[model samples]
Target chain A: MASETKLSHTTALILHALDAGLVYGFSVMEMTGLPSGTVYPALRRLERDELICSQWERQSIADAEQRPARKYYKLTVAGRATLEASRRRYPLLERLIPTVEAKQV
Target chain B: MTARVDMVVRAFQRGFLSCISLLVPSGQRAEWRREWQAELWHVRRACAPAGAVSWQAEREVTAFCLGAFQDALCLRLHAPKNEPRIALLHGSALQCLLFLGGVLAASYGLTLLLPGVRVESHPERYQVRSGLIMIQDEAYSNDWVAATIPVERFRDWETTRQRYFDGLAFYRIGEQAVSAGSHGTGGWEVAEASKNLFSLLGLPVRFASQEGEADAGLPQAILSDAVWKREFGGDPRVVGSVLRVGGRDVRIAGVAAEGGWRLPGKADVWLLERDSEIAAGGRGHVVAHLTNQGRSEMWASYVHIDAYSPDEPGDNLCGFSFEERTRGPWGIYQFTVLLAFLALPAITTVSMGEYSVSSHRPSWSRRLCRWGYMGAKIALLLPIVYFLSLDVAYWHTTLYSLASEYAQLAASFSICLFGLRWALLDQRQRCPVCLRHVTNPARVGLASRTFLAWNGTELMCTAGHTLLHVPGLPTSWFSTQRWLYLDTSWEFLFTGSGVG
Candidate 1:
């Protein structure tokens, strides 16, 4: 089922953003330059399909930063494989989102 | 000022998210709201920054909140194929109440369409319209007795009525041997009335659709509802037929509606004669329509008219009373329903068994949902009972009379009592925590050994929220059923049970 599942360009951008360590929804929205309307549903579809997983961050970490705990998202093993296949299909998916090391810089 | 603006923006975003949460499946709604709220906090920090507001950034945050709708819609659409059905025929309180409401609306719609049901349901139309008065002599204190005025005096009043009354109508009641075509002759009470009486009183006499068909030479006759049923067998063709009354042939003009026009005493027929000798010398009853000025002076029991004089001085006093209207069937229904509710405790056990101490009291919103479910069921059931009783009472007969009135009262009272009992019983079977009807009742202990074991049936909430224990036999210690709330530790037993 995963092999035949085709990803739209918007979905590919969100997957690439997640793979690039843009783990939070706002960060993925910022990196992809996509409006929240396009980004959130794509993330949900990917998560429901088991291509991505999410969890709430520890409260202590958020307390130290003096903010509410954020829900974090990351590519699963299946998600990474799907993103590799999507890159071949979309061609310029790599250029749309920077790698984790590039994002840190 | 900027801080206040930020507060407003944040509130708007949160409110939008809360609305979107409703579209998500109930099991996932809380988690979905938590994720959106957390993201909203981060989005605002990045967009507006502290102590400063950017309209562009605020717009972006607004756009982010709007996105939650698509996500919630996606989740709701893709909700598990075998997701637990919210409405189990046994348990969903909301579904049950909504079903009752639908039935009520459908019944009311039917009442509007069916003529018999329509007449019984709306009593105001058959009642006497406002401002009708029965004029009587001062000596006639008893309203039951018909008071008469000399035809000359009535004609004088009709011609010279300058105040208090718009119009005056006269009718003299007398028994006449009446015979219809092939129907046996009977002595029927007949009213010899002026031709303009019905028009003056504004009473609608239902005539056959084909007008001007009756014999022009003969006088006209309007049949009372009882005479129409008894003599003519309620055939509409009876109109335009000839009837022999007091040895004179009269053409049937129309029929009076049931429960209509009870003034000037009861009569089976009204003879509308264009020119009658009664006006020359005979005495008859008088009914008058009050003018607006007459209405203003209605507080007093009698009106002193300059036109009226007596044979002896100080004996000219005359009085008027508003026409008495029949008690509406709807009033009887309301009275019986009230009596039924008051008698409910005497017939059935009214207490819903106490919740166990181990179970936490439901939160305020949960309590509201539970009680609101009961209130909605009763609200819908009442109209259903009312319309159904009207249907039962008037199903075969088109007439609204004493018999149908009694039928409606009995039907409404019985249905209301049983319907209310069922509502309370159904509410008792529901799980307070989830407001769903508890299911899977299994008898756990022996009925004969009630002293040692907790002898009763055990019912479980389908959602794993609680278990209900109903005693098969009552004891001093365990007289009523109780509910035990199940904690998360007991949830494993309900896994793969189609509960979300």
Candidate 2:
């Protein structure tokens, strides 16, 4: 039930981007070519659905970078399960990105 | 160069985001605006080169704006209010019901405040703008002067149907001025009316009987006995003498009837415009008889006629049958249209949303009172429109018409200024929470109510912090009905039915 897979291509792309360590909203946009308006609200809905969780990056890190602090998203356990199912269902998602060992936030 | 381009991009982004937010829901609109603009900045920064906009940059900007429209559309679709539900239906239904009740209550309220106003007394006679001659009686007059009869239209419509319709061409009472005396150039108001005005309004013009004193198509003014004395000190030489008025020198045609003809606007010192015929083929104000068989009404009306409450008899009703005067929907619709069109929906929304007191006074009490003031004046001045338009002798008899309306208008002007707060003012309850006087408390609907007393009053503090201090109930619906012991009257008691 937690991994109940109803993943669309757009959702799979977003999940794959999160797994690839492109966690920030702008970073996700860079990875998936999705607009910020779409990506931000989707992030909110995903968080609401408990498939993704987010936290603001450290202010000091942003100060050093001379930019606003970015909010970061990481897949929850349920989200990971869903992603696993989505990867199988949408095999091209994996082929489109570099393979990397996913780390838990 | 890069900085300049960045500045330009940021400015354009700011303008676009501001426009997009107009469609966003009120609750999340600000937050979404800031978030999207920030994201847009990032997209543009990433896509733009150091000095100029690239094709990729423009595409990114376009995509971002398009996405913004999508998000705004979603937000606007259903930003449901978080409110309570009870006996009747859901929260949305309750809100709609409350809104409708407020409007109805306001309409009912208007009757209470403005009792005794009659609709028929309002002069409603105006002509269509089909090449009619226009006369500026004055900005304050706002009266329809006359319509011109183009030769072509006259030949086509009137001359063709001359046997059936006796309606004449070029009806107008052009406003002209006269000297109060040589006391340092004082101006007196007068009308330069067409001769047809005299016949239409049942007025008679007295031409100078002396030989050669009549107008030979020159500017000719006639002094009434009143103006004859006041301006010329009753000098008989004033007759047929030159009286300079409206920057033109004109001979006094004759002294009008003692008090001046009973005309609308009580125009004395009239000049038969030598150019009155010029309006025949020229632009003219469209005017009909001020008193028609069915009576008359003024269109483009901000002036409300005196209305007696349905609870009372309106003797001044301009002869409308009682049913027409008191019909509910038409009157309210008229007011609703009036409020919506003039104030651009704010007044309508305010009137509909604010309904704290209903029973004895109903919510629209103050508006009714203001309408009463205006309507009473209209009733009082009912004869003015007819007399003036027809250049009749009635203005002499109703000498106080203009002054009476002016007095009422002054009162209404003050009332209109106060109507803003009075729209929200509920007479039954007083606001004591803020101790900020009677004006500080607002009526916030109860979160939940049963069918019982419907909507009761709550005194709320509105200065920064919200503190609802509710007074005890005066009465409930149960006070009236003899319920069978098992009747579902408890919904009236336990749940909020009328707490809007």
Candidate 3:
């Protein structure tokens, strides 16, 4: 049902960022150049609409890194199908956000 | 920058986010706050890494924290409404009782604003002055409406009956063309009474006095409250003005207080007359103050006009017969409400279905709570019917008219019967244990298959306590609605939603 509906540009950006391995809310905001307010709420909507899913990283991992545990997002199967449809609707979406490996390298 | 300044700036950013968290709904506030706080930590680290203080980086963090307010606002706006609180008030037992109490309180408050209805509800204030009796001719003794003693007979009785009475006041109810100052002439009901009538009755003067006393002029007139409002536009200036009644210019003394207890007839104006010849010429109702012996004699005799006999002990002929002619408005309302409640079972089913003492039966406390709720609804409804009926009866008129009493009776019966019927029907639809109205009705089986099997609408208690089967048609096997208790095995159906 959620896959059938059209995704907004900001929502599609967050979904595309999640698909490209920019998983955390801050990473999505950085990649999309959207503010923290726009990225976080759009991520929440995608998660609620079942286009994306979220889980907190292990507390030990955050303690090893000496920072708070980050909530990471991953695209569901339905979300990947919806992203394919959104990619057709907004052709510049893939060019808008780069892959995590590409940005790091 | 100093360490304290950096610490203060970091604290302000976190404090702003904390304030924004309040906008989110309480159920999801903690998770929403944690998510935002975690992201904020990462953002601050990326902006100013390695314990460095950069103004641009601090400004970016501040702007990042401000975005939380919008996110928090969006979550708050989209949060599901508090469904349980709304369901608790919709058709719940507590809501029914509250609605009845609210309307009852409003009706009582309205009665305080209406003088006629207030006096009717509390009849002690309008009790006819003690020792006051009306005397009439023998021909008109049985009928107070047509009962009047000729002025000559009253004059003859005045000279002969000084030993039997203290004072006598005569009032003739008639209609005369009246005009006040610039107000046009209209036919107004007038009570032509002797100048000493107010004093003779030993009644306190209630009219508002301005220029002089109510008895300043020889032939002054006092306007009834209805007439004062209708003809004079309720002006205080009209008190001192002249009013022409039947081609005679009479000074307006003052306006009478609003009252439902007008004796003889409902008059708009009391035209006081100084000329004894004119007052003593016409036939009119005479009120006489009776001494102790006169009172004893009046009560002891049934026929006092042409023949006085001490045979009757219970009947009094010359007392306030006009009030006794009909049950007052409040009396009629009380009787009608009682009759309506008595006839309630005939109109609708009164029995709350019988409960069985099985393993599935509710606890004794739960049963007591259900009965107590039913009793509270009925207790609140009684006064609601009373005050609302009187409110409808006396809202428009200042006097007790027969039509208003009839309206009160109709309102009383209609409101009481229908209100109680709805209350019972609502109770039947509610779950006995939790007192919440059952929801999600689904039809089971065809209506034509009722003879072969149970065919009715099945409704489940939202709390998963029981299922209600209301037959589409009442048969011998399913004469009334039945409640089927859901056992512990069925608890899985209500798991995640927190019902059972």
Candidate 4:
């Protein structure tokens, strides 16, 4: 079944990337074509009000060239509940929303 | 969920910590910083989530929130560590308080240890400017013998009696009266009959020799200590120096010690009995002797002349008994003591009232303790001040009385000091409830009906409020209370508080 959730254009893009596990700031920015200014500040505000949380990922490959430490943002329980509530309020938008692509753009 | 909650809680903790900086001024920024940092640590622990995710995100959220809250809350953008920094800024104020405390301690210590403070007592030197009379004459006995002569006639003496004799005045004599022409009777009867007449003229009878010879010559002269010392250098040589006194030569038989009389220090030269009789008629001689001796004997049988001149009559010129003289001087002492005693309690109540008014703003316990301390201080200080005031009053009355101007001036100064102490104490210990100045009725009534009803004038009451340091209020209240207690106690013991 298609996921019955619809977000705003920017929100939708952010959510789509987070759901696919491409949650780091750089990864989200690269996938959604959003600038660092728009992504970073929004991430911070969301995290502040309990809607989101961010953390650094542990490096798995010791030899991998060190990429700038990426902060991974994820929806909190309250944020998930809000997403669900919004889906119920706008069922028609949920139906017309496009599916998130699995591959990185 | 719990981990996310913990993170949010840590963020809010940082915000709250940062908010404290807003409460203090920029100068106190360092103090606020330390205070808030400690406070935030407590808050973070209290808000820590109970799960694995909480452990993972707590530190990051804490740091990030700390930065964000600092930015939002700090008014001055350039300021760093605003909350923590402000918490450390109390160094100067604390130092100032410590300095003041040290100074107070040192002053208190010095006051306790120092004996340099002089205890009030009788003045050593009396300025003699009033209450003195001088008689410039000489006298002789009825036998027509040159019994005494003025110092101006020293060359006429039969011998160098001045080398071994001093002059003297006679006021009284006692012997059985003998009718005229009695047989085998000695000259004692003559001396006895003349005693009453001489006493009425304020004069004293003197023995011509140690053998109490009734027929001895009457010498009349008084010498001051200063003259005696200058002439004899305090040696025995001057005791018998034959010198002219009041133009009559007299033997300096003996030296009279200083301060032998109550008269002001003015009379030093005396005339002989023969010279006195010559200058003043027999009637005048008798009258002068009676007056000089304070007229203590029968006046009807003796000669009596007014000691005061017709134009200027001095106080108590009429002969007064020792008791009567005491009464006059004692009146002044009584008045001083009365004022001092009354002022004592009045001053205490006012001072307490002032303290209460000023200290009301402190914590309840602190205020109560402060009031108690002030009360104790007043109580402790009262006896000291009372003794001091009494001493001052007594000396001023007895010693300064020699100089009317000095005596009056001293009396005035004492009264003014008592009044000033009263006003001051009233200002210091003000009532807590009324918040009015202790001495001022419009702001704070000086006399309360309830207080008066309870005979509270004797007992100091805390009443309305604590004392305040603000201007236009009594600044001397505390000191006044201390002085009042002392003055009152002293007056009670020394003067007797029948009036207060």
Candidate 5:
């Protein structure tokens, strides 16, 4: 049940972040107000499942300011298609509620 | 909030310890740490339940997240029961070998497509003393007949002069041809005659013969294609025109194609008759003649000396020999063969070396072994290929020779591919040498204690004899440095003690 919930939210956030140019964890957090706790683990699960792909940025000015480095993520070709299909299947309200609730506390 | 912090700390610790157990080698330690931290952070957020905003609820959620994180971490840290070994098909060395093999095959294919002709002539004489003189003898009975043939008629002649010149035909001789010596007279006469005959036949003969005494005594000259183009500007009307040569007016009797004469190096001017005496008597002359079938032959003949010395009380004095001289075409073939052989090995060696170096990292012993193997393979194949190529080339079936050349190149390429793969992957290890994490170590010195287990086994086996001393000494001495040294000395001191 936890994994199923995680799979759905992670997929939704990845799609939303990708569309918003929130291609990395910090950017996703800034865009969606999701804590590092929610965003990164979802990103990893999405990557492991082949729904999204991530690559470590060789040099990051923001990372240098914060820590050593950060990995950038993007929707794979399959992920983009899946997101489009899922958007057609679910009502806009249903998708927004879970994301909003996940973001809120 | 405190409970959540405590849970987060526990999750982080578990993940960190799992990573440590996996023994993230020094080179990748930093990356593993970052990945673990990120994972811990994500686990906390994702596993947090829908809440009524209580500290106890938050604590319960965090602890649950920690437990989940530990389970995942433990799974990752444990080695798989069926860990995948590197496959021959997927290895990087294999990929490189495939790429190199394709390139070499393409190159060998391209070499076959180049257009060029390889000519063969038997006893193929390259340098000739007298090409035109030989032609005259081959054409007529003697120098007298060649001389009297009227230089205008001789221009129609076509001869193949491989070692000498090609397509030479005499046209005319000047009045002073009688004064030039045997060497000069016959060649000059032939040159003039060939020029005149080609002109009369309306064929292209580039050079004209000089008429006046000023030019006549010097030499009879035939014009080259370049000179013809320069002097006549490629004018067809200039065939019968007179030109100045050696300070005398000479008549152009014919035009010649520059390709006709196979002069040793460069030949622009051919003298008709340099000595008048030889021209008159036709003694001691050589000439080249080509049959209609394109085969060339040389003839050395003499003219009746009595014809020139008619006033003297003459006996039959044809003061020259009629001998057929033949030399085989072995020299040129040998030279080309030597060049091909010498160049092949050097090129192959370089290609093999390049393949070896690029495919694998440098290791002295491995490289040496691969080099030796490739060298032996090539050495065994070269002589057979060379002789086979020669036999094919001899029959003028050089297409087969070309094919064999390509095959040799292909074999060389294949050898290079295999050699490179063998060289590169020969000693690669599955784990990092110094830290014991999954890695490929090129050097043994860089291996860590865990990776050093194999080498340690070898050392122990080599010193197994030292474990027993006089059959009764304490085995503890094997592990101690001082006792071990004493034991080693005792074995050496008593060679007949049956340690073997």
Candidate 6:
């Protein structure tokens, strides 16, 4: 149901950030330099579009550190396709976000 | 330390989370709150290297606050065709007051009618507690162990009580003319008791004190029937006659009922505790009732000069134990009833939560959730405790002045009771979507914004649906200014391009 071609620059940036290994919300915020307001909603929209999927990090990791569990995001096949297409659409994103081949999973 | 910064951020997050609770469906409330909190935690930690009291929380939380508003609005716009938007009944103010008020009114009515934890025979006994120290139940198990009432805590309460209670009789005792009346005169020993001490002791009033008379510049005293018989020859007119107490000639306002009287010291006369008695640290016995959790406070109000733990455990009963008839068999029954009220839905201490917090810190918003729960409980109790202290302060100040005081207490306590009960009982302790009773419940409140029970937690139903929502404090007040500034700018930038 998602209109992928209409993806906004913010959405593309978030997808690229996810592919580039800036997986969690704040990490994506750091990689993209977008505010929490922008980053969270964009993530929600991308997930809704089936371009990305998220799972909570292991509880042990959060326990090892003294903090809350982080939600980790990874590109779906569709998400990878979108990121590849976005790289062409937003040329600057290629430099900002990592390519999928650079990531192991 | 990070504590100071944590305080401010926690307060903002608490209020913001309370508002967010209103937007999500009830079934999903618990889950969403946790997820959002976790997200916020990560957001803050990511910037923790910035400083302990980083500006990041302000910037980050503000964005999150705005995001909640956007989510509420956008989620509504993007709601699936079959799913209805999350909607709380948009009742008129009167309607809100009517339903919520009715629930509150009933909760208090029940509390007032129900006798709190009590020993049927010894009504004046209290379970002593203090802010600085908590006397665990083990200490209460033995015979009465004495703890010197914390004068400092009482003094702090004395100084700060005016902030919550409006009554002058109790707090403004310093302003009263310390009665120049005789302190010790006739062989008449005097006892100081609360207004309901007689009724609490299962005795009836032989002569009733007039409402407001305690504040009317008239001295008030209650004579035991024996004392009345011996001193005034049982003359009915003695009720209005003045009896010398301390330096003041306190009027004989009433005579205690005669039959089955069993008070320690068997004082000939009873009167309201005076301001000076508080200063003097009156020695008294500890009264532990199975129901009242806040007993030490009663001791702190009076009993000024004694040391805490007046006797060794060998000589005293200190801890709380119902398994052995420490007080009496009836005390056990009373405790069971109290426990039932606290644990069962529609009883006392009702918590409405769907999911318990799964893990401790490093869980995003870990400290915030724990602190928020504590803050909520304090926020709920502060006003009740405030007015309660006022009643303690205003004891016998005026005839009939107690009705309003008690009504204030009942109202506040009822609100707490109503919140937990409504979430549990009226809602059937089930997830609205799944209609399963298998749910957890918790109560939450705004930080520093005590007296309002706006935030109720949500849990997922066994059906795994997160589609129900509960009514909450309308956040219009919280949103107004922010809406004008952040929202206006927010909408100005992104209104036409609303997201799915």
Best-performing candidate as measured by DockQ:
1
Q: By TM-score, how accurate is candidate 1?
A: 0.59
Worst 10 residues of 4 chain B by lDDT: B116-125
Sort by TM-score, best first. 3, 1, 2, 6, 4, 5
- Find the candidate with the highest TM-score and give its number: 3
How high is the DockQ of candidate 6?
Answer: 0.27
lDDT of 1 by residue, B1-500 (tens): 37688788778888889998999989989988988888888887777677467788888889888888888898888887643354344447667877897888887787776667766555544665567676666556464345567776776666664588887778888888998869889899998887777877666788632453345687788998778888889888888888899999988898887656646467899988753445366567877778898888776645544344545343353555543335566777788899889989988888988787764567789989888888888888898989888877877766665567778889999999999999899989998877778889999889889998788999998889889999999899999888888888888888866644
TM-score for each prediction?
Answer: 0.59, 0.40, 0.61, 0.29, 0.26, 0.31
| Candidate achieving higher TM-score, 1 or 6 | 1
Among all windows of ten consecutive residues in candidate 2 chain B, which has the lowest summed lDDT?
A: B478-487
DockQ, cand. 3: 0.64
Cα deviation at B145, candidate 1, in Å, is: 16
lDDT at B279, model 5? 34
Q: Give the whole-model CA lDDT for all candidates, comma-separated.
A: 0.78, 0.47, 0.75, 0.38, 0.39, 0.47
Error of 5 at B142 (Å): 22
How well is each residue in A4-60 modelled by candidate 2, as lDDT tens digits?
Answer: 768678877888888865366777877787876677667766776788887766768
DockQ of each: 0.66, 0.41, 0.64, 0.02, 0.04, 0.27
Model 1, residue B110: what's the lDDT?
72
Q: Candidate 2 — which residues are off by over 4 angstroms?
A: A35-38, A100-105, B1-6, B49-59, B78-500
TM-score, cand. 3 vs. native: 0.61
Query: Which residue runs of candidate 1 sit more than 4 Å off their true CA positions?
Result: A1-10, A23-38, A54-73, A85-105, B1-76, B87-90, B120-122, B129-325, B342-347, B351-376, B396-399, B431-435, B443-500
The recovered share of true contacts, given per candidate in order, is: 0.81, 0.36, 0.86, 0.00, 0.00, 0.42
Candidate 4 lDDT tens digits, B329-430? 234445545666565655444333323222224457745754554454444333333333334334433222334323533554465356446434543543
DockQ category of candidate 3: medium
Clashing pairs in model 3, backbone N/Cα/C closer than 3 A: none
Candidate 1 clash pair list: B91-B437
User: Candidates' interface RMSDs, in order?
Assistant: 1.0, 2.8, 0.9, 13.0, 6.7, 2.1
